[model samples]
Target chain A: MLGDEAEAEDVLQETFLSAFKSIDSFEGRASLSTWLHRIATNAALMRLRKRQPLSFSVDEVTEPGNGNLIPKVFYDWCCLPESELMTQEVRDEMRAAVENLPDTLRVVFLMRDVEGFSTQETADILDLSLSAVKSRLMRARMALRERLSAYFGGAASADMEGTRYE
Target chain B: MSEKHAHRDCSHLLAGLSAYIDGEAEAALCAEIEQHLAACENCRVVVDTLRRTVLLYREEQPAPLPEGGEAAPVQSVRTG
Candidate 1:
């Protein structure tokens, strides 16, 4: 999420140190990984806030379908073959698409969709409400869909043999 | 249908789409969205690509785990 390799490593080291110092606070209610994940997320967010505080604020969560995220690119790229979609170039594009998301949406999308966390888990990790998680996730997915559409929109057709998204 | 209920509008249906794909949506809302998708080609493409986008990202390689070390203890990720 920080989008810098050195900074990401710094956050990782910081996460372990924090966990060590606060070991007594480990309630063990959630998995160790989840707890660590939360620490890591907060650490990353802290760095993000330090860099561009105004852009990282989650004070005003946007409502779903509020017109800010209206789908502009309606091309259906899901018909592309798996080999075509999973190419290194496409993967790089995928990573860039995610990296380009706003901080709030990017964090929610990573925890919920990328990490397989339940929406509630994501809310708890981010200190957001369940509804907030849902709305943010909805916006994040739509934004990514638009980005990917630019790449795969006209590359193939639904009639292509061995369609995987069917 | 009431004039106040423009729920069929593409933007309105966009709100419930993630829930619909995630199976977190109520059945009635799901029906409403699917109904809209059948008639709106753009919405159909949006929903399909949205679902696919989520799926694609879900398969992303996991982030690296923190390696354990007993080096000088410092600070945790969060702060006051």
Candidate 2:
């Protein structure tokens, strides 16, 4: 989740050092891995706060039950050849698309998808409700899907999307 | 894509899409989504591409190195 290579390197040391300093405080309520991840997440958040205004809070005001995040891209872009799918250019775009997500959704996406945390684990770690984690993850996926569609299907998706509604 | 189901509410189904994709949705939900997919071309495409999107990210993850601290030795193929 930090997204910067140098920052990640620096944060790794910081997280370990912080964890080392706080080792005695460990209550063992959560798994050792989860505890370490919590520390690392805090370190990342501190770095983010120093870099720029933080975009989200842990208790971000919830949106509507069905927030306006409907899938807008209708084209089937999955048929792209495997060779084209993971090409360097495509990979870069994928990474960029992830970076573009709002911090709230991006963090959840990373914790769940990239960090390999279960949805319940992510919610427990972040102190978010289960539903919040689920909704944020879905929004993140849908947003990335739309961004990626622009590349695989390009303008054709817009045309395909035209007939979506009644 | 049919006119008969054109105005049907697809929003509620959206909430369940991720659960459906993750194989965590209830059997009733799975059945509902499948039945919806049969008639909804747009939803079918969304589900397929959404699944592809998740797979692409998971696939992009680098493979873990071998368990040893250092390089694992490969046996020499050439006979002396």
Candidate 3:
């Protein structure tokens, strides 16, 4: 969403308007949410692309601001005393970290981790291969691990110490 | 830790980690993985990390959907 509420409103209006017009063309091949998500993602990306100039390689253009898109969170999970473990504050931070994932990664993570959906079900929702779903889920975890490294003491290092979850 | 678990690393168990955490891993493999985790610091850390993450995931309740725009226009809509 744009920093402005009004702008976000406008973008959403345009997206739904376009969706309504082509609603009849949608087949039973995909879930309604999946189809709409595709349209909405396109609309949102198009709006952002217009405002930001992209570099073109051949006919494909890469958006300018994409490279500098920082996540909303930058907190470390470690350094806290064990006394504060599983506090609401920590849970909220973890939720925010999950939300900070990119759209594709977030969707995959939600479907697999949050919803307890099978990899195949998630693949269907995202129109991706099972391997692709697994790959994205792993990437999502890695990103989260980086964000949460302070608390977990870096899984890579912890792993070296034989720190399994049990 | 059991001998089978003590001999395995996280990389070897990554594919089955989620299932194992979900308590869906087979009894034999689970015992082996558990043993390995107790002996191998790296795998133990991986388990701890994933266990904590899964706990966080379980506590996540979706926030209220935005009221405006097409933000979540059709969550209840069934097209099939």
Candidate 4:
């Protein structure tokens, strides 16, 4: 649900109207939720495009009074909790990292990783090829691993201390 | 095991292991993976880490569901 009350109402109304309008083409292949999310995403994207926000690239950073600028750290992989093997902080970091993913990657990751949708379901929902879905997921995971390695140390070493990695 | 033998070259199945753990892998591949895991310590570690990661990934039982209480405009929540 959109947090803004007015926005939520408008979304609800528009969604119903669209559904009614397209009732003839309603195929039962996808779940209602997936269809709704697709509609919502489209609506939301349009709104964001119209009301542009100030752009801030991750690379650019500013320092306070001293004038010595500090570079922003872009490594975000460690934020994802690897497997029930990490501490809460690590898990939270993982969530943040996932959240920070670009819009496309974020959607793909969420549909597959978070929502428990199969690769087929995800590809169908996103209108991406199966290979594209797999590749994107792999890339997203690799990016997370790379970032984790940067922040926490070697990818293989960071998670394995007392424990072992095969 | 020799250094060459110490690392069980299990990265090939690291991803598969996740599926295997979830009982989603093909039966033959599952058996093969388990066989590999049984003999190789290095590969075993990889499996252990990956398994642990998967557990962490799905840590919550019955994860929180969105109530849709915040009702907002459809056209406003940007996807792109």
Per-chain TM-score of chain A in candidate 4 equals 0.54
Better of 1 and 3 by lDDT: 1
Task: Give the residue spans of candidate 3 off by over 4 A.
Answer: A1-15, A41-88, A99-104, A115-118, A152-166, B1-10, B22-35, B67-80
Mind giving the per-residue lDDT tens digits that candidate 3 earns over A13-129?
Answer: 666767778989989697787666566556655665566545212222123322222222223433346556566766766776776776556667776787676787677655578
Highest lDDT: give the candidate number.
1
Query: Which candidate ranks first by DockQ, i.e. highest?
Result: 1
Q: Give the per-residue lDDT of model 1 (tens digit) for B1-80.
A: 33243334667678788899999899899999888877777778788898899888877676455454223234333342
DockQ for every model, please: 0.44, 0.28, 0.13, 0.07
RMSD list, candidates in order: 6.5, 8.7, 10.1, 11.3
Global CA lDDT of candidate 4, please? 0.53
Model 1 agreement with the true structure over A1-166: per-residue lDDT tens digits: 7888778878778888888889999999998998999999999988988898888555547533365567776667787789888888888999999899898889889888878899888988888899889988888888888889976754544445437755
True contacts kept of 2: 0.55
Q: A4-88, model 4: which lDDT tens digit per residue?
A: 4556456565776677668677796777877876676566544544443332222212212211111122222324443522656
Residue runs of model 4 more than 4 Å from their true location after superposition: A1-24, A40-88, A100-105, A131-166, B1-11, B60-69, B74-80
Q: Please give the range of 10 consecutive residues that has the lowest summed lDDT in model 2 chain B.
A: B71-80
What lDDT is reached at residue A159 by model 3? 65
TM-score of predicted structure 1:
0.83
Interface RMSD of 1: 3.9
lDDT of 4 at A93: 63
Model 3 docking tier (incorrect/acceptable/medium/high): incorrect
CAPRI class of candidate 2 = acceptable
Worst 10 residues of 4 chain B by lDDT: B71-80
